[model samples]
Target: MTIVATSTSAFYERSRANMKDLRLKAESLQAQVGSGEKLSRSSDDPVAAARLRTLSRLEKLATIDTSNADRASADLSLADSAMSNMSTAIIRAQELATQAASTTLTDDQRAGIATELDEIQKDLLALANSRDSNGHALFGGESSGNAYEFDASGNATYIGTGNSQSLPIGDGQTMDSSMTGPQIFEFTDANGNTTDVMATIKALSEALKGGSTDPTGSANDALASLKSGLDTLSTAQTVVGTRLAWLDTVAERNTNLSELRANEKSDLGGVDMTEAIASLQETLTILQASQASFTKLAGLSLFNNLS
Candidate 1:
């Protein structure tokens, strides 16, 4: 008969290894419970970790898109307000022109109207050069300076770019932040000639101040041009309103997408506290039983039995 003998040291070593393994498993579960995360490291679940990384990147991009959308909305709102005030000023100018066109008004009255028109021109220029929320030109079309500038002869000229800047909101969507100065102020008159609100007001004021052969003729001529400029401003306001509406839609969509991403992240990475705690308790119970068994077995020996 063949006999196999196991050394006491080998038995102790095997028991220690088994206890160590249980201890390690208990510790891992505890860490998971405390940290509230399923995977402690990427290697724990590489696929889930990679998906989490992608979700994090998308969240960052969504944040940027939200910021840009907010800025664009602000600038567009400012432009809309400025245009509303400008429209009011233009309507007032038209009324003043109608008064000046009447032959019953005295020279002094016409001069008084001219003074008010000059003030209105300055107001228009200020509105055209209005600043945005960031203190930059609102109608300058991405330029840093004013949208309009006056020459030595008091002629107002548009110095802004031809087109405004377009900002990306999200999901491959983009919108113009604001309209250019010329888009709001300049248009084709009834005579098929290009004219602007500021220039028309300045010319009318000059004529009323004796710069023209016939002041009433000049006032009548400016009415058509002023009306055309107001139409252009109104059209621009509609465009801005449409863009703001679109931004609102994009914001809602982005919010939904953000919520979805958060849910996905929670599903992939978040630990279930109830399950983790139950598993940890079960593991600890097994470890304790094994430890007690080892303690009793280790104390048992042939010498003790003989004693």
Candidate 2:
């Protein structure tokens, strides 16, 4: 018969190693239960960890897109309101121009109308230079200052950029936040001339105040240009409305994407609390049984039993 001899130290060492491994596994499962996360480190599940990182980056980008969309919506709304007010001012000016074109009006009444028209011009200039949510020029096309600057002669000139700024709202899409001052105010007149609302109003005000050879004739001529300016403003309002609608659509899409990302993140990284707790309990019970068995075996000596 062949007899195999094992050292007591080796037996104890093996028992301790097995118990330590079981303890570590139990602790890991407990951590997952408490933390509600399946991964303690990237090494736990490299593929899932990498995917989680990607999702986190995408969520951050979605947040930025939401901010940009909000800003664009605000600026567009402000532009719409300002344009509506401009249309109102233009309609009032049209009525005054009709009154001034009458031959029955005296020179004094014409002068009064000119003064009112000048006030309206100032109002229009103020609207053109309206500030955006960030306190920058609303219609200045990314310029920091006013859209129009007045000179010594009080004639307004466009000092803003020709094109409005485009902002990214997400999903690889971009939208213009606002329209430039010239876009809403300038149009081709009846004389085949490029003219703006401010210029038309200024010229009429001057003519009504005796700056022209014939006041009634000048008022009659301005009617066509004013009508053109109003039409231009209406077109701009429509454009703004369309952009706002597009933003709403993009917002809804972004919201759905956000929800999808959240669900994916939960599935990839979130721990199932019930399963984790049950596993932890089972591991603890086995660990306890192993520990008690090891203690009992370590205390049992062949020499003591023989004695």
Candidate 3:
């Protein structure tokens, strides 16, 4: 009969390796339970880790999109408010023009109305050249400076060079952040004449100073122009209002999508706390049993007997 001998060093080394393996497994389970993440590295589960990375990138992009949406909404809101003010100013100008159209008013009274109209024109021009939150021209289109500038003839002219500003708020979604100065304030009248509201107001103010042979006829013309100008302002307000409503809808959709992505990410990468805690307890129990068994076997060694 042949007898096989196992070296004491081999037994000790194997026992040490087994204990190390058991301890490592217990520690891993503990980490999963504590941190609420299943895998610490991609090597733990390559496919799941890859999916998690994609989700993380998407989440990061969503955060940026949300910020863009906020900025765009703010810009559009400022534009809407400015347009509303313009509409109110135009309405008040219409009232003044109607009052000046009365033959009962004297030249001095008409001149007084013109002075007020001049002030209103200046206010309207200032509103047209207003700045947004970014300090850029609100209606400047692509231009960085004022949207409207006065020519040598003192006529307010659109100095902007492009369409209104736009921003991407979300996936497949873009919003116009502003409207061009010309689009808001300049429109063709029924007479096929390109009417600039600022210029119309200027004309009305000049006519109110009473130099025409038929003063009442000139006043009536100014009143008609003022009515057309009010219509233009009203149309602009409607456009801005529609855009603002669209932004609200899109912003709500973006928020819902972001929340859905967060939930999906949690399902993909987040740990199941109950399962992890149970696994940790099981691993700890096994580690303790292994340690106790190793201690008992080591005590039975012949080296211990000799000692």
C-alpha local distance difference test of each model: 0.89, 0.92, 0.82
Candidate 2 versus the native: TM-score? 0.92
Q: For model 2, how does the per-residue alpha-carbon lDDT over 130-203 read when each residue is reduced to its tens digit?
A: 99889999999989899998888988899999889889998789999999999999999887889899899999
- Which 10 consecutive residues of model 2 have the lowest summed lDDT? 1-10
Best by lDDT: 2
Among all candidates shown, the one with the greatest TM-score: 2
Least accurate 10 contiguous residues by lDDT in model 3: 1-10
**Model 3 stretches with alpha carbons more than 4 Å out:** 1-4, 7-14, 301-307
| Cα TM-score per model | 0.91, 0.92, 0.90
lDDT of 3 by residue, 91-138 (tens): 888888888879899999989999998888988999999998899999
Of 2 and 3, which scores higher on lDDT? 2
lDDT of 2: 0.92
Q: Would you list the rank order by TM-score, best first?
A: 2, 1, 3
In model 1, which regions exceed 4 Å deviation?
A: 1-14, 301-307
